[model samples]
Target chain A: MMLAQDTREPFFRPEWVSRNADRIVEQLIEHAYLTSIAVGVGSLIAIPVGVYAYRHRRAYVPVTWLAGFLYTIPSLALFAFLTTYTGLTTLTAEIGLVSYTLLILIRNVVAGLEGVPRDTREAARAMGYTPRQLLWRVELPLAFPVIMAGIRVATVTIIGLVTVTSLIGKGGLGKFILQGIQRFFSTPIVVGAVLSVLLAILADVLLLGLQRALTPWARSRPRPEGAR
Target chain B: MSVVSEALAWLSDPVNWSGTAGIPNRVFEHVRISTVTVLAAAMIAVPVGLLIGHTGKGRFVVVTLSNVGRAIPSFAILGLALPVAIKLNLGLGFWPTFIALFALAIPPILTNTYVGVAGVDPDLVEAARGMGMADREILRRLEVRLAAPVIMVGLRTASVEVVATATLAALVAGGGLGRFIIDGFAVRDDARILGGAILVAALAICTELFMGGVEKLARPRTSTA
Candidate 1:
């Protein structure tokens, strides 16, 4: 607070903080919204595909691997390439982001679902539970831990990647960073960079909390008495 | 549209492969740049990771720092660093790209290295010490050998990711295969876009295969587990 008075630059001046505070808050919210939307959409798309593939086992390996490969494409290039067909707009960016997430989320979901100990599902089936009941009451609950771990990783990764969405002209912190670069001003760039780190941290913490909430079983189980 | 045909023609032209316009040369340079960055990041990340794991000190510090590295988002790092580079007249291109990709690649290498080493059977290490192996020898002869496969898996994944991501360096006008994809946008060339995408995808798979073979060769068989 004390250092700002010596700055000759207007934006760097102390008084500007009051004016920009709301915008910064709003920008952070907007950034969070965009990332959450992509994750939500990716989950919707991926869950069924993941479940279906997990059911079919051997047959889906090629297709799921293809999804994983596509998931590995760098976000920036994918957005730009999509823009050639879709044009530079929100739809293209959204589609690219969602597609990118599906690869991670779906594979994780499928892996998690498959990871459900076979005995549990068999017990559910033996107890005369319907297939739907098995999924909802048995498999889903047991699989929740691994599924959320995947989502947690995916969310943190997306929050960081969303900063690049500004390059496609989505007008978030990235725009400020890019503009600061163009104008040779470091404050806006610094603001963007600092917030990018903060955003990643906050997102990880939030998702970690959610993971814990969903996976109570993971923590409740103790390590074997003698184990490291 | 036609730009695709043109680029294809250019690429297919015997002259393109003959190193004219430094296309072949540029390909080698880009590969070299990307490969060196991945190796360099691994060199720094692996030992630091191994040290942290072997010592079992500052566990939180090491992990929290790696998480920050993972979270820093490559483009923002590049954006933040570029102005500093430009003003200092360090200029921008491969080195800047190398730094950014290196930062992005480290977390995977670091995390995997830590997991590979720390996850080793404690009893085995104890036995090795009981057998009177020196600390240095224990690390090189047993611990690292036991950990090699997992660490190599991480390197294999990280290298593919780095090559794909080095494409982003194009935004700052750093040359790589990303040019074909980004430039394809201005002209609306799907073929060029697809070609570039295919090339990147191929680059990833090729690196994975190459690394997988090396991983197998280095990995000790008949686990002492």
Candidate 2:
């Protein structure tokens, strides 16, 4: 009944990281790849649904209800459930991750569009802008900040969830964690956990930068006095 | 279709309803763990959020904590907590799962509480003060009542999240319906895996619906906004 791990093995091993450097990088790449696919596909689906919801008003309730229902399912359960059909593949991971982004993204999209001032829309219409032109030329730009905020949240969330996919054997850095736990080894677990957190933070900062760059007007928008 | 029927059969079996490893016990374990984690998170977050919202101090810290909090993955938290728990001789199972889900539960409650209170009309607060009410009395009678809906939204969000992530407790050798999923994976039993997933999802959805009902109940009859 000898344990494979020495009793006093250090929690972090620099040498182990050095040995597994290539695979670690590969996993990191896979993690980023999975996150991007989910968020990208999610946005594609959510934007139109959000716009429709906003335009119809009546449709918002059921749309949100459906998204909320999907969002409520825990990631582990969704991933496991998907396994019954999709098996252990990247597709299964992507489906679970994308389903999550719908609620966050759709809500944000609708909110952003709604935040466009009524006066602004009226003014655009008065200036001879068609409905389609007004939406593209004025409303979308005004809505960009709120929409970008949603994207940032969704991206960060999807990145974290990508790690959970490892439980289904598709998680990028998550595989290290699963392995580390099974073997009673601490180094890989630390590596996987730290890298994933760092990745999340990095993605957040990058998305924030993108939002700022895209919505320069948001920075100059006048805030009411004393508004935090 | 047969897979689903098989899973249904697995779920309906009376054998799955008895003993320590039974479905009922597993569900109770899940609910118990989630309940404790959410309550603990609310206790810490509500007071802090209320103070911040009421006094308008430490606003930056709360915002930053919540922003960072949302970015950390639950699994990563579980992985990181493992060593700390081991070092403290906390052993495994509940402690590690509790640590992770508790952390997951805090940000939503804290942020919602702060926003709800701060958004309370300043004129109302001024009128309360002008009527000779003390700050504590205004917070209790006016602010808390006004902010109840938002606070409940936070509670709902935290409850749903904790319940969902509580499934990961199984990954750490912790008890919960998640154990069935993990065990099903080990045995390559598709029926058990699907059945476990259905149970976990049902519980999470129920939490959401129940919380949504509570939130609606908390809404002020005369809408202030």
Candidate 3:
């Protein structure tokens, strides 16, 4: 009996797995919420800045490069800077996270707006489409795919960065990963890494779908045709 | 009054000279660590990347592995390594930090090298072969030269990354600029905090300027190069 106990033959640990399974779902929910909220909020702000700068047709490079400079700030330092004032709240985290997304999304949106074929913009103007009408009707739909790609990259990056937020007592899968490291526990670390990868893969596939749906025009022609 | 004088005193001390003072030595040491890590990672990763680019197999492996490495983040890798290294009774300070920096520098160099080499024109490669250039000669004459800028771009980014990332070595109890930054923060000293940050910014800018000059010289002098 002592030998059996010491050897620990039962490897499944069904009891432990079942107990934390609810936590896995809860953590996943929290993580998804954190990223979507940041990306969504960031996009709302960036799209307008992008549109404004594109219309001005100047200051685009400098404004966007300035944004890129801010984007390159280390994630830990960024979060720490926010929490210093806001005191470890979700709001600070959101602000810090959302601001980072702006740089990437704004750059993409500007690129997308500029990428709209010159002929199309000229045609819209020739047909007496107002700036507003052209933007709403002609520019936005074509630009959506590239903007969404930026969001995809931003979302994935923020999800990984969310781990640093655990230092602020924000519980999520990051807490699991951090705690696992602190305790030197393999199972929890493995579980967190696997779940995080799964989250990334899931996000990638979802964004792929969204990208295709938004840019149906891209798929409509189906370049290179089938057989390689 | 004495404490205040001492505080300003350290900042103004003209005796603090590069190659002469401990302060400058520390800064150079950090730069040395960063350069060595990037160069080492590049040496291995670039060759592997070129091989992969030329053969065009196992890109899936290269991409997936790099992504996986990136996903873990550098701090976590250091955290994981510290205990294992300690348990093995291995040297902890510089060696451990080097390993972590090496890991962090690999992805960009590998991926960019592969991309730069692969982006070379297949027609040029074929023509060289048709002209009876040996495979080795063709690679030396064409592939490495064509790949230089992309590889340089990768190296540039990687070098900047290591400079930024080397700060985390302080977490492993190895001394670097992060020592000042983290300590300054711990004590709520804005002077030190901002001072350390300023130093890092200065280092990054200087490194970029120097490397830009170096890259200008290193260009292989082809039309495509």
Candidate 4:
């Protein structure tokens, strides 16, 4: 594939890196910040909602339905719609990004909680532990692996979606992508795409490590080889 | 209040409903592209996923592919594909967007098929074998039937995702309902943007609901004893 006919400017210019180093760092930082904040906020909202849904079987359907509906809204449309009220602010981007995480987190949270063994819960109750105590001590700890899995999925998804926030001028790696597209410059686009993908893989690996560290029991449990 | 009213007015405008760039035409483009992408993805993912599930090998590949798919932004893929497409003389718009959307649709379908098939009860498979069913017969009659709901879930996810992401086609000057949103951005027309968002959201919701219905129907009527 011949990249454009403009052979004067190389597809990847070494000098471009030197000149745009600061801007590249800033965009990477912005991307990380936006993704973390969105994931953080989403977990806060989704966990509680998931807990509520778990406690009340009736609410599970509606809660999941609403989240799923929000998830289905195109990221671009959500950002554009929010721009109407929020006016191209970081808040607008955050709202859209956070909303996408809810469905994944909530469903996972519930599934994790539900997957807790019935015997474990009964034993906890027999030990005279209050419901709240049982939840925090027994249930939540056991649910950590599943919940962490959800968080990993949500975090990775948010990282990808954060690129789209560049559409609203939020100055993430997506900004470089859009700029590169407009100018037909391959350097910035390649740099931005590669960095964003690396960031995603890094975040996923970090989360996996965190999950392993937190859920020691999960690691110790016997399992079929290569079950994952 | 005025925003909503203005968006309604724009949507209701008869002029917006006609012409090659009309709402209907744009929606058609959107649906047509999404349908083609989703079908293409399913055709490839389903068979591969089923094979992996049935044999219980290459499970690692599915997991890795799904992770990579989730990590790469669709926009990045679109951007990356564009220069290559242009370089290959595939032009600017449709093919690049189609390729990106196609990539987006594959992971979910593949993952779901693998999960569905793998999760089928071993006892059921054993019973089928005892009943003189061949491997192919067991897969088609027992595993596939039991795995249908999970497979449908994957299809529904891919469908909604493809439909929603197809909006980015406008970014590459391809046709879709996102034209309204992109054009509005260019001209700073709030009403047009909102109208476009509404249309996109409505389409997504409708697709989700329709697929959900299909899933429910595909579900086994009686417990798999």
DockQ of each: 0.36, 0.59, 0.19, 0.55
Docking class of 4: medium
Tens digit per residue, CA lDDT, model 4, B12-71: 999999999899999999999999999999999999999999999999999999978878
**Looking at candidate 4, what is the lDDT of residue A179?**
79
Which residue pairs in candidate 2 have backbone atoms (N, alpha carbon, C) closer than 3 angstroms, thus clashing? Answer: A165-A171, A166-A171
Q: Find the candidate with the highest lDDT and give its number.
A: 2
Q: Which is better, 2 or 4, measured by DockQ?
A: 2
Best by TM-score: 2
Kept native contacts, as fractions per model, are 0.40, 0.66, 0.04, 0.62
The residue pairs in collision within model 1 are none
Query: What C-alpha lDDT does candidate 4 achieve relative to the native structure?
Result: 0.88
lDDT of 4 by residue, A25-143 (tens): 99999999999999999999988898899999999999998888888889999999999998989899999999999999999999999988888899989999999998899988988
Cα lDDT of model 3 by residue, B1-225, tens digit: 342344355445555344422357658777989988998998899989998988898899789867776566454555555445544546556776887788878888999899988999999999999999997887788998888878887887788777866765665556666655566556765444444555565576566667667767667775663
Chain A TM-score, each candidate = 0.84, 0.93, 0.87, 0.92
Which tens-of-lDDT digit does each residue in A116-135 have in candidate 1?
87777888899999998998
| Of 1 and 4, the candidate ranking higher by TM-score | 4
Clashes of each: 0, 2, 0, 0
